[model samples]
Target: MKLCTLVNKDCSKAAVLFNSKKRILEYISELAHQQLPDVSKHVILDALMTREKLGSTGIGKGIAIPHGRLQGIEQILAMVLVSEQPIAFEAIDKQPVDIFVAFIVPEGNNEEHLKTLAAIAEKLQDKSFCKQLRHAKTDQELYAVIQGDDNG
Candidate 1:
């Protein structure tokens, strides 16, 4: 359950501009749709929104892991975005979010889903890693950071 396995250069973004959490979610949905053409964008958005209502995915310290389970997905898919500015996400710490590590997992696979979520959370807990992700200037740089290569 490595971030590198779930995310790639195409799914990673840098310096994205969005005004609110909803807008950021929309962007994530769009990226998910592109990666998974078989799944509709609306379905992805609906699933994510439903999960958000249950609890804010915004973990804290300018980081968020918005995730949801969806039908028709065989495995976990991920997208990462670094916002140009922090946006309110109703996180536990009541802090704004600037880094989004979103995931779409197959429905009913609770075990793998939780495992992957925990793995991503563990990686994001590192303040320096989050800082490097925020400062990434390009999609390639962002992917490099996620792969634990700060030299990029």
Candidate 2:
């Protein structure tokens, strides 16, 4: 599973100005609704919030990956967002998060979902790559950074 396979140029956002996790999730919900209109925004938010209750998706290093499973979806959907300022995310490292990658996957596809999560994690582990992502000035630049050759 590749980041480009799940996220497109249009799904990438740069310099998102949200102050809280709830607000970020709201934006993510809106993106999910745009991609999966048949799935209710409430359902998307509920699933993501429920997952968060179990543990924070903020994996540290100024990054967070919030993901959820939905029943009606046939395939995985993803969105990438970069904040203008870091937001407190209750991450394990106790650092604020500035980069967010949200995932919505079809229910019962645990194998693929985990693979995708691992892939994203691996890609984000590169400090230089993350720096480029943070420096991206526009959505197109952000998308290019995410879809760059280093992702593999």
Off by over 4 Å in 1: 149-152
- Superposed on all Cα atoms, the candidates' RMSDs to the truth, in angstroms, are 2.1, 1.0
Predicted candidate 1, C-alpha RMSD: 2.1
TM-score per model over all chains: 0.95, 0.96
Across residues 1-152, which tens digit of lDDT does each residue of candidate 2 receive? Answer: 87777788878999999999989988899889998899889899998999999999999999999999899789889999999999999998999999999999899999989988998899889899789889998999999987874454
lDDT, residue 41, candidate 2:
90
Cα lDDT tens digits, model 1, 5-122, are 7788899999999999899999899999999999899999998999999999999888899998898889789999999989999998999999999999999999889988988898
How well does candidate 1 score on lDDT at residue 30? Answer: 93
Q: Where does model 2 exceed 4 Å of error? A: none
